[model samples]
Target chain A: MLAIFVEMFSYDFILRALIVGVLVSLCSALLGVSLVLKRYSMIGDGLSHVGFSALAFAMVLNIAPLYVAIPVVVVAAFLLLRLSENGKIRGDAAIAMISSGALALGVFAISITKGMNVDMSSYMFGSILAMDNSDVVLSICLSIMVLCLFAIFYNRIFAVTFDENFARATGINAERYNALIAFLSAVTIVLGMRMMGALLISSLIVFPPLSSMQIFKTFRNVVLSSALLSVGCFLLGLCVSYLWATPTGASVVMANILAFLFFYSIGFARDRMKG
Target chain B: MSLISCQDVTFSYEGRNVITGLNFAVDKGDYLCIVGENGSGKSTLIKGILQLKAANKGFLTLGDGLRLNEIGYLPQQTNVQKDFPASVWEVVLSGCLNALGYKPFFGKNEITRANEQMQTLHISNLRNCCYRDLSGGQQQRVLLARALCASHKLLVLDEPVTGLDPVVTMQFYHLLKEINRAQGVSIIMVTHDIKEAVSQADHILHLHNKQLYFGSVSGYMNTALGKFFSGGGQDACNLR
Candidate 1:
């Protein structure tokens, strides 16, 4: 097992994937706590679908995918935020409409262009070799920015998520902080989608916090544990994928599912003991 | 000058007036209760006072060095907070975010203030406890402490005791009364419990799509609208 680990790390592409994967996992987990608590977890799913369309359009236009995808998904995220705030359209309904529409556009683009080639499939299902040296550098810088922003505004984010009306009453710009969360999530989604695929990237933003919430009762503890759990799961999933030759995205999602179940049972047992 | 004064304020939603012709003033150290039936614009009026909503045709003045952000607010519980994983300390300390301006972390002064507020609310023992694990009454106290941490001059409570049991509700009211009397903090509370509101508050503002009465509790008891809403003349005074 130790020799196998050494061999895997020796591969340059695997190392790059691991580095970016760990960073993306950490960022998503940190933002996930706020998103899940605010009932905005679906924003991740919606944004990833938009990311798919952006990637597809980029592929058709023969441009760099990240360059096109980042701005497009960010704009879609802001539009979704505005739509939800408008109150004319319910939040879930807006997400459903936009995500499905974007998915359709992506499918349409792909069918009309290269007819679902290997590169497009990699975008859909993710490939370990998809991340280049420049991609790794970009992911590192963006991930650090996300981390620092989350840390600096941690208190305000907590206040806004816990109670927006009360936060607003105290003169905290709840909408601005909410936009910040959406913005960070958009960037994280685009960055992670390269490795986790658009279909599975949101799991990074959802599973860790939920698993930690099953046992941890306090917000600080939940956030800390969620970050640790996300990184652990990503590494574990990477190892499994390397050893078994499975898809990286599905392996990571499966690892998360297992962790969630494990924590849930522990919580259940604790409750029974108390009773 | 009054701490807050609303002059003929009219608030509209989607171009339809939800509250109209609202005129009232909250003086320093005053305890005012706002009561109204469902759709009677009590919430709209509160929003207007809090500066969450702008009035279409009236002016709202905040005098006596009271900024909109300095008003301690204990809003009604939302579903999002019911299961939130937060420590009591985190929730209470968050009230100081407005004063924290540009500082990333809470200062020692803010920390000491949060501890003091927690002590005042008698929740010092529950500082590290998870918020969701507490009883409804305890949760309200945590939120009240949070609100108190924001401002020393005034408190704005929107149906603060909606879900607690009767015993807890009375205890909560007793705590608020103590705070109001001891600290000289002005309070503007919106509640559905008219009898309790009449007894606890020094002044009453009743609304029925408009301001029906705004005066001392005694004066409100004399008005026909207050008498009817307070469940009758003699019982209202007796409760007080």
Candidate 2:
């Protein structure tokens, strides 16, 4: 078994997928705690759907997917934020509107592009073998940016996420921090969509923090454990997919679900013991 | 200079005038209770002073070397905010985040400040406890400790004892009084509990029918409206 695991890394595609997967998982978990606590987890799903449409457009135009998707998704994120803040639309409703609209656009674009039929399933459900060297480099660079930005603004993020009004009253620009979260999340969602697919990427953003919350009470602990859990789950899922001939994205999501249940059971048993 | 002063402050919402030509001043170390009937804009006045809502007209200033960030505020509670997932320590420590502009993390000084405030509120043992798991009174203490961590100059609280039981309310009031008397932190509180406000506050600002009455607590009690409110008439008092 150990030799088989070692042999898997010898393949360039597998190595690239593992690197991107682990990086995406770590980035997702770092932002997930705040997003979940702030009731903004669905933004990830919304932005991923938007990314799908943007990727289809990029494919039709024969441009780099990230170049097309990043700006479009970030704009959509800011638009959603503005609408919610101005009371023009609610958060969930705005997400639903953009998400479904983008999903429809993506399908329409795909139907029109004859050559795009080859990798449609891979785009929708993700394929570990699809990552090239360029994808690995871009993912590495963007993931590092997300991590550094998150670390640099950790305390400010905590303050804004915990109580935005109070944070604003204390001279922190809550809206700016909120915008930063949205923008970074848009980038993360777009990048993860390449590996996890548009449909499954948000689970990467939600499950780790939720699982961590079951075991940890403090924000710092939740963030730290979430990072650990996310990376661990991604690696475990990758291993399972390679050994069992399953889909990588689906496998990772399953690992996350199981981890959530496991942590929840531990929390429940601890509560019982205390009672 | 007074810690907080609002001159001819007029605040409106959706074209409806909430307060027109309201004026009041809170000097350093003064416990000023703002009393008003429902729809009289007591809470709006707090918001206007805190700059959460900008005043439509007139000037509001913080003095005695106090800036907006130096004023600790305990906003009115809502159902959603109470469900936030954080520890008592995190919540309190977040109060000093304003002081760490552009810094990557909280310093040891901020942590020590949070600890001291928790000790002051006697919630040191509950530091690791989840905020959502705390009882109503304990939660209020945690919030008060958070507010304390924000500022030593002035604390602006909007109905800090709203959901507490009578015993807890009295205990909370005594705690505020101690913080005010011992530490010399100025307090500007909004409350409908005329009795408690009268008993605890040194000064009072009564808002009624677009009129502002700023006076000592005893002076306010001597007025006919104050007599009506303190006599348990309850018409002008809103517990909500």
Report lDDT (CA) for all predictions.
0.92, 0.88
Per-residue lDDT of model 1, residues B1-240, tens digit only: 999998998888888888888889999999999998889998988887778888898888899999879999999889998889999999999999889988999999999999999999899999889899999999999999999999999999999999899999999999999999999999999998899999999999988888888999999888776777777667657766
Native-to-model Cα distance after best TM-score fit, residue A7 in candidate 2, in Å: 1.8
RMSD of each: 2.2, 2.3
- Top model number, DockQ: 1
> In candidate 1, what fraction of native interface contacts survive?
0.93
Candidate 2, A78-146: lDDT as tens digits? 987777677767878988998999989988888887545757777778888767788789989999999
Best by TM-score: 1
Candidate 2 docking classification: medium
What are the per-residue Cα lDDT tens digits for candidate 2 across B10-30?
A: 888988888887777899899
lDDT by residue (A29-125, candidate 1, tens digit) is: 9999999998889989999999999999998999888889989999988988888778788999999999999989998998897897887778888
Q: Which ten residues in a row have the lowest lDDT in candidate 2 chain B?
A: B231-240
**Candidate 1 residue spans exceeding 4 A from truth:** B232-240
